[model samples]
Target: MKTIAVLGLGKIGSLAAVLLRQAGLQVTGFDQAAKALHDIPVLSDDISSPEVLKCLCADHDAVLSCLPYHLNAMVAAAAHQAGIHYFDLTEDVSTTGFIRELSARGNSLMAPQCGLAPGFVGIVGASLVAGFDECRSLRMRVGALPQNPTGLMGYAFNWSPEGVVNEYLNDCEVIEDGERKLVSAMEWLETLYIDGVKLEAFTTSGGLGTMCETYHGRIANLDYKSMRYPGHVQLMNFFFHELLMRERRDIAGEILTNAKPPVDQDVVYVHVAAEGLVSGALRRSEFVRTYRPIEIGGKPRTAIAWTTSASVVAVIEMVRNGSLPQNGFLKQEDIPLDRFLETDTGRLFN
Candidate 1:
């Protein structure tokens, strides 16, 4: 069996290691915190140290990074130098660009943005676009929210606070009128209804992954948004824009993280829509799903943790079985949605 090393034994990483081990692969974990991985054999190594990071990744066939977005570059470089494949769940565009550059010079695969929005949502969006003869417009939306919200924002810290703040503050990339453009986050707000629950969506960064470049001139309009409960965007806009929190994202992240506690009972929502001409008539296709917390390895995991971790693990399985290209930068859209859901790990979304 192939051996894999999972870095960052935090919320998503711990579950990812569990899934990898349950798949019968030899799995080793590493974390900066000593107590992050108590149930499994792990090394409490400092990821900031180049020599130590390289040594930890050198023996593995592939390394999955669940560390914070800012730390991905160091880990990715180490994995590349160690001649091992690298995968990460980062939604940071700048980090992904760096990994893409590393992949150009490395012998092993380097895949970033392997989590929910840029990951499975991109796969679903691409599939919907493929159904059209002439694609006109496409929109992808995803959200991880508390099932029973108690806060003023009606949200919780389901994932990394740094990631959340970064996406909200960064400029978003989209395709408009057959040309790629950069738009402000939290703009273009719209209301959406899912399963009779009212929610809102707005432009978000990095969720589109490489889709804009892939479908730039081919489609007239394309965008990705983050969905949230009603009134969430207004409060966020007031805090980030009116209060100038956008300029101080680090402080903003701290305030939000401290205010909104992470919840165990969370849900993940995904929706994708494509409109274009099929044959001679205009047609629209959509994919939608709501994911709840589920039991994995005899333990109940939050929906966000399971969905995010499952996506990266499924992609790793695909790489191991030679289904995906193994020697270059990999995009979420490269994996077909049907094929992804068929995998043991991807089934968690079903």
Candidate 2:
């Protein structure tokens, strides 16, 4: 864990490398084209080839992938062959399943969905459930929005459009009425308010990660949703369903990103709640936060970029220092929220 290779040096990936390097790890970044970073060294290489990926991973203590979800399975397989811990911010359910299979055969740790909703939100939800004697339900929601939103959609493409589109179209996993079932995304729409800001939430895939399996028989109701300004879901449904853009994910991503590119000023909203009987009495616990862009590395980063980067970097910090298990599949719920908040990079969440 002393040396790490960060693959895909995009905005979030580049920032993750910087945070890890700042925390005193020997970090190297791999991408198609090397971007000039102040202190950290980035290498340009064709990692799409499996041989190149394996050779690159063989040199590092761990490999943190920031590549697209479609490529994570290949990168993870390479890391497993190289015998190093593998981490990624992927929310693709199939990709995570592939990583889970690889983790069983390798001695190194394999952790996926280690960012934002699937990462930090799961940690918070598990912490809240710990207070109840018998937990009945847990609800988690997160949103990355433009601070000053415009248009009927009232949204911005601050994250990967392919990821967003996939979430919107994929089947979501939820434990409802004591049954773990798959439901259509964008269904189960509900309205919620965080800090007096009105928002709408709906079921989204991969936001729950592996929580449904971990709490399958223990909890009666468990779900995760994506929050957005009001009327966002309806327009998205029209764009994807009526317009038939769901089949054209690549073109849809290009269209959406072209229309609503990443914004410098954005906000991340998180709402998590758990309910059950505590000491034989019904009770509820909630964790709500409104996070905005902050100054990092002498520049302002978008809320989505930093929050997503910090969560994974903090987890890496914990693993490097033995705060987290070093081998096998790492589940988000297994991470302690308090301890996670204490890491140098984790302090950003606080």
Candidate 3:
């Protein structure tokens, strides 16, 4: 059996271990916290430590990290040293760039930003361009929302809170006039209606993956943003920026995590729109996907967990199936759209 090691057994990491084990890989997990993995064995080691991570990677065919964005470089470096394929779900632009540089010369694959936004969002965007010849504009929006929002924030903690704050504060990368430009985060707000329910979308970091780089000079006015219920932007901005909670992210995270509970009845909303000429005719293609809570093996998993896990699983399958280059950096756009939507796990989005 192929052996795989997962670093960081947090919420997402824990789910990933279960999914990979179910997929028939011999899995070993390492994390700072003592985790419950049912029948699977847990390896007590700190992956953030370079020495220990290198040793752990030495015995595994590949290393999948579910740690925060800040810890991704450490794991990537260790994976590079151990000659193992490295994969992560980070959306930090700088971190993805570093991973790209490492992939340029590495002997094994390094795939990052393989989560919901940079992950599945990229796949949808590329698919849109494939069907249209003279592409005009492409818009992609996604949200992991609580089914019953009961707080002033009107949200719950489904994923990384720190990751949420980083995305809000960072400058977003966009493609306008067929050129790359950095747009101020939280600007360019727009109201959207999904399923006849109103929601707001705005600039957020790393949701576009290398789309801007891939679609540059090919299309104009291509952008990606995060979606939230109406008034979420104004409320969050007041708390994050005005209250200066932006600097105290850890505190803000703690407060939110303590006040707002994680909900099982949550949904993941995906919307992709592409406008261009098809067969010498002006046209547009729009795909909207919403994943609700699903029960796998009597356990209820949120849409965020399902979507996020599938993102990494799909990419890993692609690499294993020889659909992607075995060595060096791999961009999300490097994976074909149809192939992605055709994979056994990829069909979940459908």
Candidate 4:
């Protein structure tokens, strides 16, 4: 897996290629047009064709897709047929399900949901209770927001607006009171504090990945949510419900992104907690951090960009070095947090 090809040279994709190259791997980028991003060699080609994608993927040992979720099934299918390992940052549950099915028949690894909320957060949640006797609950919350806000929404489209919308509208999976079930998104609301800053969290889809299935019998309660500034969720509920924007997610996403475009000065907050019995005593473990835009390749990148990109890059690094399984459907909960932090790119999270 020394030679890697990154598809979709957008914000996260371009930065991921730079990080992979920085990790000492041979990196190439692909997109609709050939354009230089940082120091990586980018090639322009249409990946919509299965034949073209399979041919392109065969040339590399692995393929990392940073494309939108709607196009990932095709990419994974191509990778499967090419007998090359595949990775993606998709948070779409259906897309992950399709990839999981594809992985069953393929010899190479198919890893998806390798981004921040579903990726690193899942890894952290499992690590928090690794030594517990009886895991009680695991709660995870993540947010990427404008550092300085001046709007009713108090957000910026630093991440994929489509992804944000999907998380809001889609039903969330959870394990409540030892029973696994589906719950309406945005129904469970809670207030949390980090460094004395108040914020709100609500249920969101796909953030839990496959954790419900993995922790069904082991954990009593488990859930994931998205954090936002105070009053942010209220406005969203009103906008989607009262204004009837839920019927048209595409248009809603477009309108939201245009109103609050991405900002250079942004922050990403991650807070995770797990409670269980340690030594016959109730104990709680927490992993909390606030990430801001940092310098990469002598230029600053947004917090959302670096966190999301570095996450998958580190997982790929581990895969290349044999720290992770080489084939089959890789679960984020199965990745050891210690080994993940030992990787070159994963160290950035520290």
Judge candidate 4 at residue 97 and give its lDDT.
Answer: 99
Per-residue lDDT for 216-261 in model 3, tens only?
8889889988998888889878888899988887788777677776
- Flag the better candidate by TM-score, 2 or 3: 2
lDDT of 2 by residue, 257-350 (tens): 8888888989999999999998899998999999999989988888999999999999999999899998999999999999999999999988
Task: Estimate, for each residue in 1-350, the C-alpha lDDT of model 1 and write its tens digit.
Answer: 29988988887999999999877678888876756453568888777898888787878889999998999999999999988999999989999999999999978999998989889899888899889899999999998999998867999987898999988889999999988999999999999999988999999889999999999889999999999998898999999989988889768888998899899999999989999999989999999999999998778899999999999999888888788998889988888888788888988777
Model 4 poorest 10 in a row by lDDT: 46-55
Clashes of each: 0, 0, 1, 0
For candidate 2, the 10 contiguous residues with the lowest summed lDDT are 49-58
Report lDDT per candidate.
Answer: 0.89, 0.94, 0.84, 0.93
Better of 1 and 4 by lDDT: 4
Q: Which ten residues in a row have the lowest lDDT in candidate 1?
A: 31-40
| Superposed Cα deviation of residue 275, candidate 3 (Å) | 0.6
The candidate, 1 or 4, that scores higher on TM-score is 4
Q: Kindly provide the TM-score of model 4 when superposed on the true structure, using C-alpha atoms.
A: 0.98
Ranking by lDDT: 2, 4, 1, 3
lDDT digits (tens) for residues 1-350 of candidate 4: 88899999888999999999999989989988788887788888888877779778988999999998999999998899888999999999999999999999978999999999799999999999797899899999998888898788888888888998999999999999999999988879999998888899999999999999999999999999999999999999998888999999979999999999989999999999999999899998899999999999888898999999999999999999999999999999999999999999999999
Q: Candidate 2, clashing residue pairs?
A: none
